[model samples]
Target: MDVAVEVEDLWFTYPGSTEPTLRGINLRIERGSFTIIAGPSGCGKTTLCRCFNGLIPHFYGGTLRGRVLVNGIDVASRSTHELAREVGMVFQEPEDQLICLSVEREIAFGPENLGLPTEEVKSRVEEALKALRIEHLRDKAPFELSGGEQQKVAIAAALALKPSVLVLDEPTSNLDPVSALELTKALIELNEEGLTVILVEHRLDLVARYADQVVLMDRGAVLVQGDPREALSSEEALRLGVAVPKPIRLFKQLLVHGVKLARPPLTSEELAEGLVEFLGRHRG
Candidate 1:
């Protein structure tokens, strides 16, 4: 698999701040992978996500020691505009990016700013809307859409820029349960279509089922990162206050009671299947 993002010995301190937010961080995100980043608040999750898109040293003046690479290009040296082509960052609040009047215009806004030809901009807008399945909402005003639709438009706008990697920081925090689930399904489809996705979310139950890799962070460093079942179910991650998915947690609790399963499950459906198989083996 191609490497999408690489970080080496990264450390950074914001302007007018004495302490660093990230300390000696190292990570590698493979292309077309879906990665979930989890940890308690203020554990440098946001700061690290910023590095992926050159927001660390480019937009925010900070003392950065180390290197961040996106698609094999050094992030520290690239301008934010340059990085935007390769990494699309969607913040916690989707409203922060919905500045345009209509969904199509919103998607067109980024390419237009990049000075692309009018035809190219229109083409990108059309592709983004269709790719996101938001074509029905194209001509509608963004403010009038539902929360889920609004977030979809925001993601479509980011996709219009043709980024290879999409970094979302707590994207579903503000949405209702149904909206959050809808957004999660959309992200999974996007990742399946080969867009590398890095999500920093607290709602494990919502996205854990779709994760290809799980990363746990704490106190300005990555505690552990690996296969979702292994990393999310470990005792170490739970000790650090990282919230594992409920179904995965149940598997862990079962293991403590001398009930051994062949493998941990990442979703409710998997957990149910595992339990049935286990019970069949130990039939009373």
Candidate 2:
């Protein structure tokens, strides 16, 4: 029930850019919750994520205003390296994150840089390998792995940091459909295991079912923010071009024609079950 991240009136402009990429953004994400931020391309989704882990003002060299806090610590007051300990970030492209040659080395990179003992670093690496189910690929070269495997490695590296919050910006962008689904399932599993997850994604139909909270942003401002059931199905979200999961879309379409569903469904399985029950009742 505690807040993992809080943003207040956050405004920022990149170095040499005349306009601000983000404006008046306010959001509160609960700890251990899986939250998704969905918006059109160039909606400042990535810019906002950079702010989450203190990369905006610290590393990106931007003119930042307002405040962004992660785990009660102000982002602007901290160094990127300090923030990396509290907030782990995975970029859209896993290739960008493959700093080391082998998967084992990549996962150990963070802890090693943190000055942990050799045994502690190895233990962290082993823990991340187990957590991400990528131990078999430990000695393999990251570049030689499949896109999904590489993405999993990137996530494992972040997990090795044991951060309080994990912010992923379009983590599945380069993945196949199956790989994307796997990535989302992995995120849900992590959240269930007590890691706070903040995802910036575009494929809502696949990811929506896993998100407890959905946020819609446009023109560098939050348009809707709440439970996925309410926020993802809102007219404002749709009008703003945020894609609603098909189950909810179908449910809404059926209701418009006088057919009432048991309730709004966030997944296809729920919709199917509800429809079967409704048909059975009518046939009786």
Candidate 3:
């Protein structure tokens, strides 16, 4: 399989900190996969993302020992300008990343920085806006949009760069529940369209239904990584404070209530089917 990101024995520490935030971490993400990195705060989920896009050892100063490769280029060796083409990062706070006066310009900024032709940039800007279903907000100032709208605009901006991999750090952290769900749906659609997505989020319930792979981290180290079904089923995930999907947890609880099912259900639809079978078997 084509690898979109590779981290080998990666380690990093901030300037003032005596201990390293990340330690000997290794992971590989396949191209076009939707992967989630989930864990409690300070577990290095965000730090690991920085390495994926060359922000750690490049933009932030620290003692770094390891190799982080994105799209086959070593992050240590690539400039931010070079990495921007292959990897687009959407920060937790959109305000920190947004600078363009209008939503359209914000989406257009990255493509413009890549020195894309005026016509090509325009095409990408339009396509990105359409993809995120935000074309209506094009002419409005970014500051005027709602939190969810701002995030969509931020994502649209990242998309405009046409990156092979997109890393998002808690993209839905600041939105209302409805907006969060909408953004999650948009991200799932993007993944279906074949963009490799790496998400760092605490909202496990929102992502559990859509994630192909889950990477559970703790104290800057990977605790588990695998298919979402297997990974989320592990006790370590719960013990580490990684958010558990309510449906999956509810399924497990039903088992405690003497309900029997063939398999643990991860989605509401599956859970409903399991309940039907359990009730029918008990009735018979």
lDDT string, candidate 3, 63-182, tens digits: 899899888899999888888889988988888888889998998888888888999999999999999999999999988999899999999998888899999999999989999999
Weakest 10 consecutive residues of candidate 3 by summed lDDT: 258-267
lDDT comparison, 1 vs 3, better candidate = 1
Strongest candidate by TM-score: 1
lDDT tens digits by residue: candidate 1, 109-150: 999999999999999999999887889999899888987788
Q: Which lDDT tens digits does candidate 2 get at residues 69-176? A: 999999999888889988999998889779788999999999999999999999999999988888999999999999899989998998888998999989888999
Error of 2 at 269 (Å): 2.7
Each candidate structure's TM-score, on Cα atoms with residue i matched to residue i, is 0.95, 0.95, 0.95
lDDT of each: 0.90, 0.90, 0.88
**Which run of 10 residues does model 2 get worst, by summed lDDT?**
236-245
TM match of model 3 to true structure: 0.95
What TM-score would candidate 1 get against the native?
0.95
For candidate 3, what is the lDDT?
Answer: 0.88
Off by over 4 Å in 3: 257-260, 277-284
Give the clashing residue pairs of candidate 3, or none: none
